[model samples]
Target: MPFTIDNTILLFSLLLFIGVFTTKFSARFGLPSLVFFIAVGMVLSKFIYYDNAALTQLFGIMALIVILFEGGLQTKWRNVREVMVPSLSLATLGVVLTTLVIGVSAKFILDVSWLEGMLFGAIVGSTDAAAVFAVLGNKNIKQRLTSTLEVESGTNDPMAVFLTVSFIQLIQSPNANIFTLILSFFWQMGLGLALGLLLGKIAVWCINKINLDSSGLYPVLAMAFAIFTYSSTSLLKGSGLLAVYMMALWVGNSDLTFRHSIFRFNEGFAWMMQILMFILLGLLVFPAELVQITWQGIALSVLLMFVARPIGVFISTMLMKFTAKEKALISWAGLRGAVPIVLATYPLLAGMENGHLFFNVVFFVVLSSALIQGATISPLAHALGLSQGKKSVVPHTLELVSMGKTNHEIVEVHVDEHSGADGKELRQLKMPQDSLVNAIIREQKMITPRGNTRLQAGDTLYVLARKGQNEEIKALFHQQVTEQDSANV
Candidate 1:
């Protein structure tokens, strides 16, 4: 049936209502809301049919672009750098290893042809950042592990997609040369990276240069720009997913105006995309096909979870100086998600033989990974001794506003030992220029500083630093600590 305005509005309204309530319901039941979203989609599919596959596919792709961009925007460069080497290795080499392992195992054990087996492997190889981000957000996990998983998921899709598409091409055209395949892969990834960075920089310039009256609308404009970047890159034969993610990350980490509102908007939008994507995928599957694929799918999933994933993790982290426990956790945390199911649709759309089985198998794999890895993350962290009790809270940014002839600025800083103000007289430690020691809270007691007032360890001191001197003052304090640590050593 042709899509009518009423149908569009009604479907969207139902989706939004399901998205909101399922989140709360999932939380209450200790279940992943993605499961509920998929279930909802399945239920809707029975009653309301969309006869147009192209429209459904377009929606899925568009949703993925939005989801990837939002994930990129949330990625912190600081966090990415901490696990850069391992994360890169995991995303690239690990994906290759996983694909090869699953491919080989499927070909030999499941008696599938080489190309078909590899296709199956390639489809399931990439981890879903949307799933990982949704599950791990606001959860207390070790920074390094969390960062590694998040970074890997965020960056791995390009490589996985390249492999999947490359294999698909090879399967369709068996006469294609190896050199051609290699060149195409490099071209796609390189162009995608370049385009993403270029577009992101351009968008940043535009956002900062264009002074808009309504700050609230800036985020919406920014989101539109992000989508445009992805679409343009993909049209140019580049990886749209890669470009969108990189651009989002750049915008997110930059000093954009209305940063808080932008993040909030993206966060909600991302969740909505995820819910819609999972539901659409679930609706695409038939329960009978899912059952037929179950036995072999379960076998492949075991090989993926227990064999392929661990080997991939080992190869990626072997050179790194991680503890045994850390390695174990990393190996176990390779969670499959919506990406596999999405990729499975490709083969089915192409009318490949046994494509229904492929989709069903991919669905089962995603479910198993989410159920096992998602549930055990916290326990695994605790077992590895990587769970830092509660995250130490720190305020890193402060807002400043001004009125005629007076200015008010909020200051934020961390309480670290060896700070000049630590275990010493606040007066004795020379204050930076144009700064006032405003408030000090030590062990829940707010005390006003006097000339003889001594600062203690664990005291959070809020200083009213002068406008435009905040950076200099912070530098001075940090410099004092470096010198103190050197003296002690």
Candidate 2:
């Protein structure tokens, strides 16, 4: 069952089926699906002889883009706004601290050169998007806490990437000056930010202004532009990863036509990419090499879990208002995934002397993180009294979009069981100024809203509002919501 042309399609389909099917069982057992995905890859690895650093790196980049784009689409800008400073610090300073601690300690523990140790540190510094998504999907938590973690995991990859590449360059060119490296970092990030924002606005403009016969073409156009953002930014020595994410953030928060469809499509696609990347990385491994790095792997894993991760979380989030419990949960939630394995391939592709060792050590660290941290996140969140109960919602109406150009948005807002809109008259809801309630669909019938119309649960409001008042409208209905309220599930 090696990954080759013989029965290729059959093996591919089988892997996908098995991988997806295991998720249900994994969820039932409080096990993260990422761990299962890697396990599937590792099991298939026993039968395959696949190893190519360059090819793995290429596919890994594509997977990351798709994953990050999906993450951006779902991330609400409002949720991230209050947590921005802390998230930014976590993404940048947290990554640096983790790298330094792990790198410095690796020199003593793994007996590697300072450069090699830092390279290892840089590869595994940030929490993984896929890993976080999987574990957190099972738990119900406060929105602010969830938002902080999600934003950090989604955005930190770029900083981790910058450090890895910079350290690699330093290894290759020993005379690389500190000033040059610092300048390069700022240049890459600044240019990436400018380009991503510009492209996102341009993408929205094209989507709204351009009219194609088929609605499908709009999504195609958006996808093409997103790919262009990453590729073009990379060509200019900018952070393509950061650009893709920022582009996704802007487009996702915008009120675009057929956005619901696009969100669903990208989510499914991200999962597909995750499955392929994890299994492929798994299939690409040689068990003999993993065996050889056992003691070194254990030592490195302990240091990362105990020392590097806690320091990164506490110091980075010090200025923020996170409680001691929240910081503890954050530290314990930093699970690594396929990203580090993919990054480890960089050394191999660059012809570094310890590339093999780097890959093996990274594989061990990822395995340990997924098993240890992944297994404990839910229980730990509960112990810290941070886990909120999950609530299930049924979609009552489609987010309908009309044809032709329009600046106004028609949103279907759900009235929670105890939300202010639950019993208050329509006028008392205190919605944003200039907002209009087009119709209220109760029990499968439409009622034209009036000042005294009493709202209730299971009532779907067809409210018309200005394009930028989404958060405001949502606030009007969430009056009774507590701080422990989970996201709009």
Candidate 3:
């Protein structure tokens, strides 16, 4: 059978369908969706040959841009603000520390040259945003711990990219000064940070002011600027990944036109990017080649999980307010995914002596991390007494798409079994003057909220209220603490 453009489209569509469908099993089996996505690619690898490292590398970059931007957009600023200092510390210094430990340890364990070992360490140094976000999606851990890990994963890529590129240069030129490279790192980071913030503020202003003919154009405009931010920063010798992430963070947190619509669109787009990236990486692997690196990969994975990551977390978070348990969970949650495999392609693209070896080893390590650490995060959290249990699933969802700047937003308030407002009629409750119940969701059915309607336990209220009324609204609906509850606390 001759493979034509039609055939390519058909295959691509089928892969995407399977990838999306794989999430059901992920939820049912308590594994990360990425694990299933990659597995599907590997299972089909024999039939579909994909050995283009350069093309894979390009796709990886595009995917990461969308993923990071969407992640930043969805994250709340208040959550990130409290842990910014520690998160940045872990994202920068912690990455460096992890790389150093793994590099030094690999020199002896893998019996490789100093440069090669360091190169390997740099490849897998940063925790993957896709993996972290996917695993931690609904796992109700402590807010501080979650924020720290999320911010760290979202921000650490630039350091890994820098270290990987610098080491590749050192390997090619052997006489390059380490001091000069270290200085270049600072220059790149500083410029990236400045450009990201500048462009982000400008982007937000433009978004708020521009009135396009079609509302759909808003998201399109945002997407174009996001890519431009990365390219423009990179062309000027800055950290493109960091610029993209910071830019999205600023834009996402700002009050802009159709903010909810833009967020929803970007989120779906990010999922497609994730599926494409993992499947492509999965197809790149050959089972025959991976067998050769099994022992080496396992050894390095153990070292990274147990030694390198812990040391990095402890050292980076020292003097901070995190407990030992919090730090331990953070260390264990550093699961590598597409980013490390993407970095592995660097040596291959550069045509290094051990290019193939580098790619295979890194691929094995990533698979191991995703399979082991990724699968066990929830159980480990529970055992450490840090798990808050899974979040209650709401059958219905509500979103407020703003047409223009407004102070009103939709908030979901859940009624507990014996909450303050559980048995009260909607008219009897003391709601803020500006607040209105949009709808009541109970037992997976939507109810038109009337003044005489009584609020039942387990009902989810979608209330449209002005921004400042949340505290009063929550207080009215929140379950009051009784003597028994106080005793339990």
Candidate 4:
């Protein structure tokens, strides 16, 4: 049947339903959800004639903005700060090294020009934030390892973006000034950082000061500013993606109203964007085209996984305190996702003659990376004795709603066997003066706390406490209590 607005909506909704449903199988099989979502797009490609590259590009950018912004929101400033130096080195120098190595390899394998080969390298250089975040979900991985990977993935995109755009310009005009390009990269990144900080401060102030009748509108206000930050930054010749992530990092770490609600809303929203991004990318290509470059794609993928990425990690972390195994895992964990496929579209849109080849090859590399690296990261971590094991599943959750600025937060504390408060009555525990046990959850059941109710191992406590009392309250609940410690409290 011919397309109509009603039928379009019907078809789109059906596709989304299938995409969301695919998550179950993804979890069951221990595969990245991107695999299923992209497969759905490819299968649908046979029945649906959606080959609009421009539309895919537009949607991809919007999706990345939301995804990165949500990433920033979830990241803790202290965690990022601790690993800042090494992560930056990986994001910048690692990307450049990876690009050069892969570029040189592709030059020989594909018989392409140095610049063209490097362009392909630049396209796939950065480890994707979406893929990294998804694979590392709630894993009991060591904090240092997790923080390094997360920070690196979040910060590396701008470098890849710069390289891709610059190489495209050079490919078009071989005589373009190298110094001018270098200056441009610094300007874009510098302005992006400044704008992100400025807009983040403005956004937090607005969210706290503006009292909307409906609580829901606060998130809407935040969403609006997020989009504006990206577009406005790009319009001024800055790196919009970096700006979006930076703005979110600041907002997420700052004290503000509806902070928890804002995070919850964006988390769901970001998932939606991820689904759409992969599917759209999947729809943009023909599987038959991928077959033509199977050998070449696999060659580049192997080179990237075995040689390029490893070299990048080793050289980048050579001075850092990471162990041999940690660096090795970091190398293997550099899985590609939507960002690469999104970046591949740049060559096509920029009028590169072999753009389709670039896109198909990048698509193949991502699929292989996700399947190979994504599937094995957990087991490898376990094998290396770096896995912290999975965190406990807490069925019930609590959030504090704030209509204005407040110092109160609902913090979750787990009572393990080692905790001194595990067998003590609620009234006997010496919590901070302003803190209160709001509720307790055990075995998925919520229980109202009474003065005489005893805490048990495996219980989850929702404690409402002042902002600065987190360490004290957590220690009271989780640490071993001695006679002197109790007396001091």
Most accurate candidate by lDDT: 4
Per-model TM-score versus the true fold:
0.82, 0.88, 0.92, 0.94
lDDT of 2 by residue, 1-489 (tens): 355686898888888898889889777877778778888888877777688778888998888888878788777798889888888898899989999999998777777789888988999998888788767755787778877888888878888888898899999999989798889899999988899889989988888788777665666777787789999999999988889889999998886766666777777878888888888888777777888889988988998999999999999998889999999888888889867888899899899998888898899899888888888888888888998766434221234455434556666787767565577788876678887889988889998899999988778887777665766777655544642255455
User: How many pairs of residues in model 2 come into backbone collision?
Assistant: 0
Candidate 2 Cα outliers beyond 4 Å, as residue runs: 1-6, 391-397, 401-410, 423-473, 479-489
Write the residue-wise lDDT of candidate 1 on 46-69 in tens digits.
776633445556777777788877
Report the poorest 10 consecutive residues by lDDT, candidate 1.
Answer: 397-406
After TM-score superposition, the amount by which residue 227's alpha carbon in candidate 4 deviates from its true location, in angstroms, is: 1.6
Candidate 1: clashing pairs of residues = none
Over all chains combined, what TM-score does candidate 2 have?
0.88
Candidates by lDDT, descending order: 4, 3, 2, 1
Give the winner by TM-score. 4
Judging by lDDT, tell me the better candidate of 2 and 4: 4
lDDT of 3: 0.86
- Error (Å) of candidate 2 at residue 464 is 7.7
Model 1: what TM-score?
A: 0.82
Q: Give the distance in Å from residue 59's predicted Cα in candidate 3 to where it truly belongs.
A: 0.6
